[model samples]
Target: MDKMDKDEPRWLNEAELNAWKAFNTLIIKLPAALDSQLRNNSGLSHFEYLVLAALSDAPQRALQMSTLAVLANGSLSRLSHVVKRLVKHGYVYRETAPGDGRCTLAVLTDQGYRKLAGSAPGHVEQVRSLVVDALEPEQIEQLRHISQQILHAMDPDLPCPDRR
Candidate 1:
């Protein structure tokens, strides 16, 4: 088998180029839109909302910081910084895991739960208005499949959140 020359790159063709452009635009714009909505309506960034929501879904409303990072799609360092902010807001607290002295856990306080509950409706409406309501039922399913394929290509072992 002959090796391909390094100078010959596999460039995207016309249709692929157009698709990439559209997808790239979406990737750039969607988060900004969501973050703007979240900031304006809930006083939270998208990542902060993700962290709170992840904790809210956990059993006992707590999770190990490392696990929380994965669920929130953030680095441990980034999670640590955000957690600090949340802690200062009286939204979340940190403690040692019950049986694991070396591991730390993040717990949602009652105030945190109420904040999440209050913020959820507006966030959900923003999501629905921006994405869900813009698609037909079949397109939504196709979007899911397409997203899963892309995610799998990025990291086969990445854990995606369960659909409601």
Candidate 2:
């Protein structure tokens, strides 16, 4: 007989349960470890580093705020707050779009560019050490596909970040 009652919901099988547990653990711990490294070495949080890195990669080091929010995988409100902090720190500036005044643009300052350049090596090293080096070549490809699948499921309309 099934342990679940007829009225109860379906639950994970043992194999599924184990995978879920490991996935959940990785989701929780990976960010913390990355965050600690960034905060300790660069005085930036992981998210902040992402925001800067995204902008740095943009043409003219500028992007529409909305686009940046998506690239940074954050809500507009959250991105706004981070941008405000970056502005205060003299790393970014916000301005209205030329023809589309309704659209706000985030421009990464030279300071921001320099900061990102300085931190990038450390960030890349951490990423390689913690994730890339840990995975076999086949596993790396699998990870990319799995991540994209999950991202597509979550928001099919959202553009893939790495496609740029």
Candidate 3:
């Protein structure tokens, strides 16, 4: 074994470095790709689509703002900006929760539901074409598993449900 060099900073090994670079490339490129696809097909940004999708999955198509932020994989400040845009478009409505009036809820209006329903076909096709179709089923499963492992290592306390 080589002598330990105390003055040098520890860095990722080759495998680790390649993995990190690949993931970093994905983080940089995937959003722009998805946004372009969404905008071209639906006149909506990726962020807007995420907001609608989150609300559509909630009970009665409604979710608290804090919960929406987490589920949509966005910060509250970002969600606020998106919500304002959605509100102006008549796609969503925000109000105090019925049980706890202080808690804010973002409810998917009928317009929002329709818009998501319309965009989903194209979105699903884009996802399959870009991601799912590239992998065998086993590889897809491993990807999900590996992604979960890395996510857990990075965020030990975040409340993530099923990795899907």
TM-score of each: 0.93, 0.91, 0.89
Question: For candidate 3, lDDT tens digit of each residue in 22-132?
Answer: 989988988898899999999889989999998998889999999999888889999999999999999999899998988999999999999999999998898898789
Model 1 regions lying over 4 Å from their true place: 1-7, 160-164
Check candidate 3 and list the clashing pairs: none
lDDT of 3: 0.90
Off by over 4 Å in 3: 1-8, 160-164
- lDDT: worst 10-residue window of model 2: 155-164
Off by over 4 Å in 2: 1-8, 161-164
In terms of TM-score, how similar is model 2 to the real structure?
0.91
Give the winner by lDDT: 1 or 2: 1
lDDT of 1 by residue, 31-81 (tens): 999899889988989999999999999999999999999999899999999
Q: What are the RMSD figures for all models against the true structure?
A: 2.3, 3.0, 2.7
Model 3 poorest ten-residue lDDT run:
1-10
Local distance difference test scores for all models: 0.93, 0.91, 0.90
Candidates, ranked, TM-score:
1, 2, 3
> Which residue pairs come into collision in candidate 2?
none
lDDT of 2: 0.91
